[model samples]
Target: MIKNHLSQVFYCFIITIILVFNSCKDKINSENQTKTEQTEVSKTVYASSVIPFFDQWKLILGDGSNAGIATEFENKDFFYTQNDGKDNWVVFKSPNGGDTHGTSNNTRTELAQTKKWYPKTANDKLSATLKVMNVSATGDATVAASHSVVVGQIHSADAFENEPLKIFYKKYPGHTKGSVFWHYEINTAGDDNAKRWDYSSAVWGNDFSVVGSDVSTFPEEPKEGIELGEEFSYQVVVKDGIMNLTFTSPNHETKTFTKNLLLSEYTTKSDIPEQTKKLFFPIGQDGVERSEAYAGEGCFFKLGCYNQTNGKSPEVNKNWCSGAETHGGDIQKQYADGNYAEVWFKTGSISVSDTAVSNDGYFAKND
Candidate 1:
């Protein structure tokens, strides 16, 4: 009996030791896994990657001292000027328009246009960031109508044959007060008016001129409204002619849209509007006609702006007013000339912050 009791005690001691060892091993493994995830998430583009593009332009703008002119830089080709005074905000022609624009207090530096590179052929990967800041607005505004942004290609001097892997964001301005809506359109190589597409337009065919279908799919409009003074972030990927768009709010709520497309489907010879067609090519010495004479010359990128509909009566003026009285109306147009469109190889992955606003009103690191 004594021998049996001693053996039983020994067995119990061994079982307890085994249980404790297993528990400790499990805890260590879990901790290591968590550490690995954190390291992976921290790898996003820092200020260093973005600063060089704007540095030279900032020096020319004199740190935003001038008040009446809004200067803009292209990829080293054409410069754009807009009347940026109190009530006359118009884009004019300035000799040094591509010099400098505005300075951000965060880095205390001037801001310049970030050039986007288009691949030589289809199926090439292309990515870019379009940063929009509300410089001076008393009330909260939502980005309403769908605006177009140009990617690859050179000048509108030629036919836009090479289709781009395009991606853009859609803003939903539901019924919320002070909410704004923004739409994005992506154009490939072609005449200005020929390549333009709008999100609000219906998706009919694979025509490059038709909105959404030529580049990538846009998200469904939101039923509920987003509040005013709110900031939104969008990330997009275009790989091998496949495009994907993702949207995230300050709260980290995310949504994604993906589609597969062929480059040939978008190349069509449809009858486009005279104004739209003119936008396809550069304004030459005799600035008004569609100059297919300069075909294959390459087209650069351009950014278009539109107003959103607030519940307020149409009497309430909401359109973004500018000084270029000659071509003033619904679309606020800005173009980047071709010479500056240089290509750069991106090394690591890019991760942007959910909110562009920092405590001090500057772009903050992604939270």
Candidate 2:
């Protein structure tokens, strides 16, 4: 009787162990299924869909890859969106170095408006509300990394090889405030742009040329400066052959500047202003200008985080080519090492000719 009872208890113990094992296995499988479902559902929304003005814009990441104009898209390593407690914002990101387009050595994850228009059009407008997030911190304080990201631009589509406008936000390593500035690329009085340089204007802080005496030194922060994640808005209007630019923020003054894009303003070296002379003194870039600059050139607009940092030797040009860190194409390594630039756009809108056409064959193109 005792042996029989022991046998019965042993069998019961084995049965209970099998039941527990099966229960745990089922739970693990269930959790994996749920996680898979959540991932699938989250992919339904994308940058082009959630962000406004996406219909007129397409994305190109730092690696020079993109999904053809589509509403559903996401690049894991570059362009995407994230919520910041208050709201969701489209995020543009790029490594310090990666595959690039054109003659530019810098890499960016930015948006290009598919539409093309002349700067002389009756009225072409582009506007956006954005904030700077991060720039590569590994570059020389005087170089482009100092201004890690360019939020917007007016790029020439023809042979001019010109970016008439580039809006920039720059910050120092330990400073509490960054700067808001814009650059004016020379339309160069003639086709010989070999000697041209951008003329920067301060919107709320020191212009791009305000560098420290040495790489380790830093200039005084602007009396009225901008900080990372501080929201701001800008509007670019090209009407009557002139470009009107406006920058605004809640704490900063509303600043405006009007430039004639169709005509050449710098026709000669003497035409350069005193401020420009002082600013560009180091580079010795002062050169003669052509008579007809950027006239009759096709122009378009671009928006996103265009990184200004590179791995080039700082000894070559500490101001523009500081030896910033680059992790090759290892994106995960780059991000972990903080070798990337990031920008955020909360709102945006675009306007072209009423002709309903753009560079891409959309309604405006057919019209």
Cα RMSDs, all models? 20.1, 4.3
Estimate, for each residue in 143-173, the C-alpha lDDT of model 1 and write its tens digit. Answer: 1212211122111212332222222222322
Provide the lDDT at 52 for model 2.
56
Go through the candidates in order and give each one's C-alpha lDDT. 0.27, 0.76
Native-to-model Cα distance after best TM-score fit, residue 51 in candidate 1, in Å: 5.8
- How does residue 10 of candidate 2 score in lDDT? 100
Q: Which stretches of candidate 2 lie over 4 Å from their true place?
A: 1-44, 278-284, 355-367
How well is each residue in 1-367 modelled by candidate 2, as lDDT tens digits? 9999999999999999999999999999999999999998876557766565777777777886654464667777887778899877888898887787556768877777786676656478889899888877666765644545788998876665578899998887777788888988786654476566778888988788787666677788777999888999999998867889999999889999988887777877788877667645466656655555666777778898888888887666545676777876677787887788888888888888863245653213212
TM-score of 1: 0.31
lDDT winner among the candidates?
A: 2
Name the lDDT of candidate 1.
0.27
TM-score: model 2 vs. ground truth: 0.85
> How does candidate 2 score on lDDT?
0.76
